[model samples]
Target: MPHQQTIERKTARTTTKFTGEVTCKGGSSRGIVKDLSAAGICFQLYFDINATTGQEVSIKSDEFGHLTGVVQWYRGDKIGIRLNVSSNTSAQISSYYKYFR
Candidate 1:
């Protein structure tokens, strides 16, 4: 069997660990942002919550401020989000991670 690439990521991702807030459907939870990219982000919530693909979510952190995105996938306590911002905004957010790197 050959390894398959199930998801094709448009932008490169960088490892990061930061505490942030994730808001969805009137509920909010604390999550640890694990990895970030210009196009998407992956974070692990402190607790399990109801979240599904296409659900709208808002993420805020001291590093990236506020970002609006849609849930792309969720597994266990981890969730992935695809940002709704433009490339310019993505670039700005990516720049913030440089200091952490």
Candidate 2:
């Protein structure tokens, strides 16, 4: 039997920039998505969209569709959100990564 190489799964991904929104404890704010994967999404906000780690929110994009996620990380105005609805459209999103790189 031949051994198959283990493909490491990565949630850190880049895709075509899209207009999106994130709703959390602070409130909903408009932002631009830098990238996305089955696990999470990284976004950039022009202004501070107040939020914190583990905060649940809604993320919507015309091209990628809607998703539920939690705030995974943030630095300054850039943030990463871990997706709860990772299965709905993972394959579709994974393909988008090629354009971003």
Candidate 1 local lDDT, 1-101, one digit each (tens): 99987977678898989999999984788989999988888989987668889999989988888888999999998999998988766666966867556
How well is each residue in 1-101 modelled by candidate 2, as lDDT tens digits?
A: 99999867565455747888887778778889987666778888766768898888787776666788889888998888888764566754655554434
Worst 10 residues of 2 by lDDT: 92-101
| Candidate closest to the true structure, highest lDDT | 1
Consecutive 10-residue window with the lowest summed lDDT within model 1: 92-101
Runs in model 1 lying further than 4 Å from the true structure: none
**C-alpha RMSD of each candidate structure in angstroms:** 2.2, 7.3
Please give the lDDT score at residue 86 for candidate 2.
Answer: 44
